[model samples]
Target: MNEDERVELVRLLPPPARPELSADRHRLLRGHLMSELREQPVRVRRGRPGRVVVPALAGGLALALVLTGGGSASGPDRSQAPQATQAPQAQPSAGSAPLNAAPVAAVRLLNQAADAADRAQDTTPRGDQFVYVKSVQTYPSTDEATGEATKGTPQNREIWRSVDGSRWGLLVMDGQRRPTGQDLKDPHARPDEPAPHPLGGGWLEPTPGNTGPSGYAYAAALPTDPDQLLAKLKADTKGQGPGPDQEAFATIGDILREQLVPSPVRAALYRAAARIPGVTVVDEVTDAVGRQGVAVARLDSGGVVETQWIFDRSSFEFLGERTVAVKDDGSWRKGEVTGQTTILGRAVVDQVGDRP
Candidate 1:
C-alpha cells in the first residue's frame, strides 16, 4: 500500500493492549514484524465506486496484538481494568468564565494546547526524513535508606529518528557521542561485548522491535474524537501496567514526547487525558530543565512518585516531564525531584543527525 493509504488503514485498526514482555523483547518483535510488512510489494487496485482500500494483514496484525499484549481482534476487554475515579473540576480563573472553569483548568489548558497544535504550521516529512528533538535530562540521586536527595547531573540530549521507522536514529548526550548500533545495544559497546540496556541511550539503527502501536504512523492514525481517543488509549493500555489510569496517562505522555502525532491527534490526546480520573492540576512547577509551567499530574497508588507534565503557563505549550517524590521511599524524600526532562525543541529534518 502507498504511505497515505497505509497510514489511514493502520490508524483504523485499534492498537493492541500491551503484552507482558521485557521492553527490549517487545521492541525487537515489533521492529522485525513492521519491517517485514514494509517489504511486501505495494499493490494498487480499483475500489468500490469512489474509494481505495488496502486489505488488512490478518496474520501480521494478530501477531502484533498478541506480542504487544493488545488482547484479541475484538479489542482488549477493559472489564477487568480499574475504573477511573471522578475528579472535582477546578474553579474558573480570571475573567474567562466561559472556558476557564477551575474544576477543569487542567483540561482547559490541554484544550488550549490542542488549539495551538491545530494552528501550528508543520511540515509533512518524507519517509527518509527525521524528527529531531532536543532536550535536557536530569536524574537525581537519593540515599536508599533515608530517601534524602543527593547530587545529580543534567545532560543535554539530542535525538533524531527516521520518520518512516527504518530504525536509523541517533542520540547525543552532553556533547558526548554514543556508539552507533542497529538497535538497542550497549552504548558503551566493544567488538566483544554487545547487549545494552533496551531503554538506554545510544546511536541506533533499525532493530527488530516496535513500541506497541506507537511512532509516527500509529500516532497519525489515532482517532481525533476525544471520547473515542480516550477509549482507544484505555483499551491500548488495559491491564498492562501498574493500573489503567496510571498506564493510560503514561501512554499519553509517551505519545506527546516520543512521536510526531498530528496536531488534531495531539489535541485529542490532551483532551483524552483530561477525562482520566485523578488527574489534577499543580498550578506551578519546574521541569528538569528549570523552566516553570503549570502542571497536570497523576499519582501512583503507593504515592511514592507523582508524574507531572509541565507546560507553559500562558502559551500552554508542553515544557517537560517530571517525577516528584510524593512520599518518602527508602531512596527519596517527599517533594524531592527524582527525574526531569526539559524539551527544548522539536522539528522535522532532512536527514538523521541534522539539527532542527
Candidate 2:
C-alpha cells in the first residue's frame, strides 16, 4: 500500500489491548509528534473526495514506534516514575462551620479526598458495558453577531459511553436523545461521522481511543502513581491549553467528573493534582444546582479566571466544578461565574440508553 493507504489502514484498525509504550513514554512521544505536525503541512491526496485527514495518526505512529520494544532499547527508568505512597488518613472538619471557617490547605484536602477515594468500592465493567453519567451544567454563550457573551440557563445532560471503545453510545440533552460514534458502513461516510440512530441503522465504528476520556479501558490504563501520572498529563497536554500546570489540573478534573476510575487510579489522580502549582482551597462554593460545598481551585496562567472542583464537606465526595473570574477582564466582572456543572450520578450499565 501507498503511504496514504497505510495511514488509513492503521486508523481503521482497533486500538491495541494495551498500549505498547508506558503511559509516560506514549504521551511524550505523542506530544512530540503532534508538535511536529503543527509545524508542518498536512498532506492530502489530490482527488480523494470525502477522506478527512486524521490527526490521531500521530498517536498511531507513536504506538507503532515502541511496538515489540523496537524503538527504545531500554525502557523508561522505573525509579524516575512516581512512586506510590500510603497517604495519611484525615477526617473532614465537622459541620457547616468548617466550610466557612477558614481556607484549608490544598494538599490537606486533596490527601483527604484521596483517602476517601481509596476506601470506595472498586467496580470494573466488562468490555461491552457502558458508563452512564448525569449532570446539570451551564456556560456562557457568545453571540456571533453581537459579540456578547451571556450566561446560559442550567440544563440537564446525560451520556452513556462504551466501556472498551467498541460500541455506539448515547447522549441526552434536556429530553432529546442523540446517538454517538461514526456510521462505518455508509459508502460516503467519514470516519468521524456521528451515528444516525440507535435502531436499524448503520454499523457504528469503534470509539477512537483518543476521543473519550471516560472510557473504562482508557481510565484503567492510566498510571496509578501520582508523579508518573502528572508527568504523563503534562507531556500529553503540552501545548494545547493556557499552560501545562493549568491544563494538567483541568485534565484531572475532567477525568474525575464523569469517569468511573479505578480506586487506586482515582486516589493517584487526587494526589497528583496536589502536586500541581497554584492549587488552593476555597472556603465555600456553590455548584450549578445551588449545592454548597468546599472547593479545590487553581488560578489560570492569566490570573483572570479560577477553576474549582467542589466536594461534599463531610464525605469528601466530588460534587461538581465551576469557573469564576478573579479579575475584571473586560468581558466578565470579578467573582462572576463563567461556567458551572453539578454531577447528579454515574454508574455502569448494560446498554446505551440504560441508567444506573
Candidate 3:
C-alpha cells in the first residue's frame, strides 16, 4: 500500500470499546506513525482532514495514563480505587528571575538537601506494597491556530505505583480511577503473551525492565554514589530532550516527584544534580501551591526556559518545582510560568487505594 493509503486505512479502524493497547502493539504503531511522518511535518490544528488535535493538558493526562498503564476502568467488574481528599489549588505566581550564576550557592544547597535526605526516616516497602504520591501541577497550553500561550489550571493528581514492578498500579485524576498494567494471572506469562485486561481487551504483558522512570525497583537499584549516579543518568538518558545535562536534571526531578526512593539513593540523586553544568541557585521562587522557597535551576538549550526545583528556604526540604520562561520565545513571554508542581505528600501504602 502507498503511504497515504496505509495511513488512511489505519485511521479508518473502529475505535476500541475499551482504550487498551498492548505494549508491543503500541510501540509498533508509534514507530510506524513516526516513520510515515518523518518526511512531513504534521501541524496540529483544527479543521485539518487528516490531523488530530488534542488539548495540551488532556494530552499530558493521556501521556501519564500510557506511562502508568492506566486509564478509565470501563467494566462494572472493575473496582474503583480509593480517592484521597482533594487539596485546594494555589494561585500560580509569575516566578522569580534568575539573579546570577551562583554555582557555589547551588552546590551548597544541593549538598544540604542530600544530607537531609540521608537523615530522613524512610521505611523500605515490601514487594506487594504501593508507593502513593499526591501533588498539584499546572502546565502551559498553546492555541494551535494563534500559537498564543496560556497557563493551564492547577490540577490535583494522585498516583499509586507497584513497589517491585510485578503488579498493576493506579492513577487518580479528575475523580476517575485508572488502573495501570495488565492483571497477569499467569506469573510466567512472557511479554509477547496476550494478557486480558481487568476491564476488557487484550494487552501484551510488559517486559520486566528497570527502565521505567517511576518504578521504585529502578530507583532503589540506582548507584548510591553521586558521581556514578550522574554518569548512569547521562548514559541512560543520552540523546533525549534538548541536551544531556538538562535531561539528567529533568529525569531526577521526575523520580523525586513520583517514586519513593531510599534515603541513600535520594541523597545521591541530589548530589548528582549538583554536578551538572549550567545549574544555578535562584534565591526565591514559588511552587504551584504558592509556597515561597529557594531553587536550583537550569536553562534549556535555547536559553528561553529555566526549570527550577524549589525547596523550603529554612528547612532545605523539597517543596516542588516550576518552569519559567527566561526569554521571550515568540509565543511565550519572559517571566511567564510555563509549568509548575507542588508535592503534597508521598508514602508507601499497603494497597492501591490505601493512604499512608
Candidate 4:
C-alpha cells in the first residue's frame, strides 16, 4: 500500500471516525492497485468508540440495577402543589413495553422476584447488607394525599431485619391519626456504613416519615419467587380483611386488618376477589430472563366476571399484575392494585462471599 491508496481510502471514511485517521491513510490508498489490501496496523488510528459495559451487579447486590425512568404526576393538570418523590416520573420510551410483551420472561422474572422476597423473609442480615422497607400509605382518592397524610385514608405497614446473625429488627411505620406504636426497639442496630450487604442487607434510609401518603404498602419488598410469594400472600391473606365493612378482603366483621393492600395495584381485582370468598389462579404466562413469571385467575370474589393478572410465580422480579376495585356505591372503578418495590436485593458475592 502506497501514499495514493491511503489518501483515497481516507476520503471515504465517515466524519466522527475519519477524524481519527492519519494523513498517511489517504497517501497509501492513492496507490492501491486492488480493493483488497494486506492486514497491517492503521498508521492513522480512528479508535473505535469505547463501549460502556453495564455492571450486572453492584453494591453487593446480584440483581442488575435497571433504572425505570419517568414518573410524573399524570391525570389532568391539577392545581394542587406537588410533593417530592424519590423516583422520576417513569418516562415511557419506545423501548418500553406493555404489561403483556414477552410473556415468558415476564413470568420467570416475577417468580424469581417472589422467590427473592421469600428468601429475604428468611435471610439473616449480616455485614453491610440489610433488609428493610422505606414506607407505605393509602389514599381514599388519588387526590386524597393532599399534602396531609393524617386526613387521608388509614394506612399501616411494618419492617423487620436480621443482620450478622442478629435478631429480627422491626420498624413499624406511624400515622398521625392511629400510630401503630411500633418503634425501632433494637438500639444495637446500625445503619449500613459501607456498600450494600449480601443475603438481605441494604437499607437506603427511610423515605422520611409522613412524606405524602405511600406508607410501606407493598413498596417494601424482599426478593422471592413469584409462585411462593403469591401463594404466601394468598395464604396469609385468606379469611383476612379488617373486619367486614373495613376489610378489603374476605372479612370476619367490619374490621379491616391489613391496610387494604387491596392488591395495592390490581386493587380492583384483589378487592373484588376478596369479596369472592375464594379467589385463585387458573392460568399463567411465562416471561423472559428465565427467572420470572405471571398468572391469570378466575376470582370467585364477585361474579367471577373479572380477570386478575398475577406478576409473581415464586420470586418477585417484575412481571404483570393488575386488579379492579368496586366502590361502595355499587359502582366499579379499576386500577392496578398489585405492585412491588426494591425491598431487598442480593448478589452472588454478597451471599457467597468474595474469593481470593
Candidate 5:
C-alpha cells in the first residue's frame, strides 16, 4: 500500500489501549472472526501485541489489528513476507455469528438502554444540590503544512449546576499545548504543558439553554410514548433549521447529551429516534476517551455533519456523542470529526464547584 493508504488503513484498526471496551463488542468480534476462519481453510497466527496475522486465503483475505493510532503494530512493515502455515478446518456452531449477520434492531437497542437506565440510581436531586459533570473533548484542526486533519489537545471542562436553577452555575475549563520534541526543537518551543483557564470558574444564571437544569427537567418530564415524544421534539425544533426532522433529530441528541432525564423518558427518546428516517446503526465506534461502543447515527439534511450517539454494546450505557462531516464543504473536510464530547464523570453535589 502507498503511504496515504497505509495511514488510512491504520485509522481503521481498533485502538490498542481501550480500557472501556464493552463486553458485546468483544463477543461480536471474537465470534465473527472465529466463524469466518472456521469456514475457510486458513490458519490464523498472533503477532506482537495488537497485531493479527491471517494468511492469504481462497475466498477472501481480511486482517484485523487492534492497536494504538500511528503505532508500529498499526502500520506493519511489509518489506518481508512471512512463512505460511496450514490449519485444520473446524465447524462453527449456529450461535457463532457476525454482528452483521444478526444485528440488534434499533428498537431493541433502545429498550435495552431503557432497562439499564431503570436500574441506575438516578436520584432526584434536592434544590440545593448541584448537578456536576466533567468531560474531555478535542476539536479537529488542519495542519498548515500538509493540510491533513489533526486534533488539538484534549480540553477538560467541569460544570456544576443548581438543580432548581434558583442559584448560579459554575464552569471550569483547561487547555494544553503539545510539546516540541528535542530532535526538532525550535527556539520558541516549550515543554508540553497545560494552559489552564483563569483560576476562577465562570458563573452562569439559570436559563432555557442546554447548559442549565431547566432543559434537563423538561426532558425528564417528556412523555414516554415514542409517538408523543417524537411529536413534541418536532414541535419544539420547528423553524430552528432547514428541515424539521433533521432539527428534531439533532435536538434529541442535544437533550440526551446535555440533560439527565428519567429512565422512561430516556427510553422514549431513543425509541423516538428510531422512528426518524435515515437512522442507522454502526456495529463499532470509539469515543474521544478511547472507549469503544456501538453507535446510532443519522444524516442531518439541514447540516453538513452527521450526528452519532454512542453507547456501551452490552449495557447500552451512554458513552459519548460526536459529529462527522458528511462531505467536504470547505468549512470542514469530508469524514472530519467536527465535534466530540466524552463524559468522564457525573453526579449531584451539595455545593457549587464540588465535583462528584
Candidate 6:
C-alpha cells in the first residue's frame, strides 16, 4: 500500500486495537511514508480492492504513550508496581451560585485565577479529531547546585469541555509529554487498563518488580492526603541514591506524586486549601463525575492566582489544576499542576496547597 493508503487504513482500525501494534508495523508505516515522500511507488501489491485493511499494528505510538524523557524519575517501567488508593473527600457545600457563604477572600482570589486560566483555555483547544496522541507524566526537575527551577515536559496539553459538566470531550495533542503513562484520548474506562482519565487512577507498584500495566492495579489504594502518602517516599528511598532534604523534600515529593494525576487527588489539595486561614474562594463550581461531583476552586495566595478542578466532590477525585503566579520582578510564571500550564483557562481558579 502507498503511504496515504496505509495511513488511511490505520485510521480505520478501532481505537482499542490501535495501540496493540508491534514495532515492525510502526516501522513499516514510517518506511512507506518516507518512501512516498521520495516519490516512490506503492511497495505492497494491490490486494484486490481495499479489504478494510488493518495492519499488524494499526496505531503508531503517536509519541510513545508509555515512554518519554531522558531521565528515569519519569515514565513507566514494566517491572514497577502501582499504588492503589481512593481520592479524598472535600468539605461539601451547595453549588457555586451559593458560594457567597464561602470565605469572602477565597471567593475574590479564586475568581481572579479562574478567569486567567479560563482565558488561556479559550485561546487553546485540545486538537482536531483527526489527530492521534498518547499520554505521559512529567515532574519538575531542578538544578542541584543553584536550586534554579525549570519547567518540565507536560504530561499532555489537553482541553475538555462539557456544557452541563457531565461528559467531557477530550482535546488531545499527539506526543504531548505528561506526568502519567496512559492514552489521553482513550474511549473506554475498562477495568485495570492504563488509560487517561479526568480523575485517573494511581500507581501502587512502587517496586521495581512492578512496572507498567503488569505491576499496576488501578483505584484508590494510593492515599491522596499529605500524611497518608508519606510512606511512599520512605519506601522509595531504599536502594536508590540519596534524595533531597527530608521533611520539605518528602512533602514536595508527595505533592508531585499526587497532584493533578487524578481529579480526586487534586481535590484533596483544594479541600486542604479551603481550610487555610488567608486563602479565599472567589468562585465555586460543581460538575458530575459519573455519579459524584467535582468542585472547581478559584482562589489566591501569596501573590499568585491558583485554580483547581476537583472531581468526586464528596471524595478527592481531582480532575486537574493550573496556577499562574506573579513573580517578584513584576513578571509572571505559571505554577505547576500535573506539571503543565497552571492555567486550564477557566473562569474560576480552584484546587490548592502549592505543588512543589
Q: Best by TM-score, which number?
A: 2
For every candidate structure, what is the RMSD over all alpha carbons to the true structure, in angstroms?
21.5, 23.0, 26.9, 25.5, 21.4, 29.5
lDDT of candidate 2 at residue 89, scale 0 to 100? 59
Model 6: runs farther than 4 Å from truth?
Answer: 1-173, 176-279, 284-302, 305-307, 310-317, 326-329, 333-356
lDDT of 3 by residue, 182-201 (tens): 34345564444433323332
Off by over 4 Å in 4: 1-130, 134-158, 163-168, 172-300, 304-316, 319-322, 326-356
lDDT of 1 by residue, 1-356 (tens): 89888767766765544446667767776666644543443232344321122344443364555465653345556563443455996765885323212224455456667777777776777777777888888887677998777757899888877777765576778767455543436565444333443434565555323345546766777899988988888888788988888888998888787556778888888878887887766665777656777778888877789888888866678888888888768667888878887889988888656665
lDDT of 6 by residue, 1-356 (tens): 89888767656653321224456655665555433322321122233331111121212232233222122334344232322344995654763222222333332232332223223322211212111112233446777997766656644433332222222223443333244333444555334533444443332212232221111111123445634443443354444433322322323223423222233433333333433343322223332212332233333434454444333332222333334342432233543242322222232111111111
Best lDDT among the predictions, by candidate number: 2
Candidate 2 residue lDDT tens string, 1-356? 89888867766765433225577766787556534543343233323221212333444445457443333545444342333455995655764222211122565677778878988997788888888889998888999999988878888888777888878666667874443333224456556655454433233346756254556776788899999999998987889798898889998888888778899998999989988877766765777777777788888888889998998877788998999998887779988989987899989999877767
Model 5 global lDDT (CA atoms, 0 to 1): 0.63
When sorted by TM-score, best at the front, the candidate numbers are 2, 3, 1, 5, 4, 6
> What lDDT does candidate 1 reach at residue 141?
69
What lDDT, from 0 to 1, does candidate 2 have? 0.72
Lowest summed lDDT across 10 adjacent residues in model 6 is found at 347-356
Per-residue C-alpha lDDT of model 5 across residues 155-261, encoded as one tens digit per residue: 88777766766666667767322232332455543343223224454555555333422355677668899889899888876688768778778888777774567
TM-score of each: 0.62, 0.65, 0.63, 0.25, 0.59, 0.24
Worst 10 residues of 2 by lDDT: 95-104
Sorted by lDDT, highest first, which candidate order results? 2, 3, 1, 5, 6, 4
Clash count of each predicted structure = 24, 0, 1, 129, 1, 71
How far residue 329's Cα lies from its native spot in candidate 2, in Å, is 2.7
Q: How does each model score on lDDT?
A: 0.68, 0.72, 0.71, 0.30, 0.63, 0.33
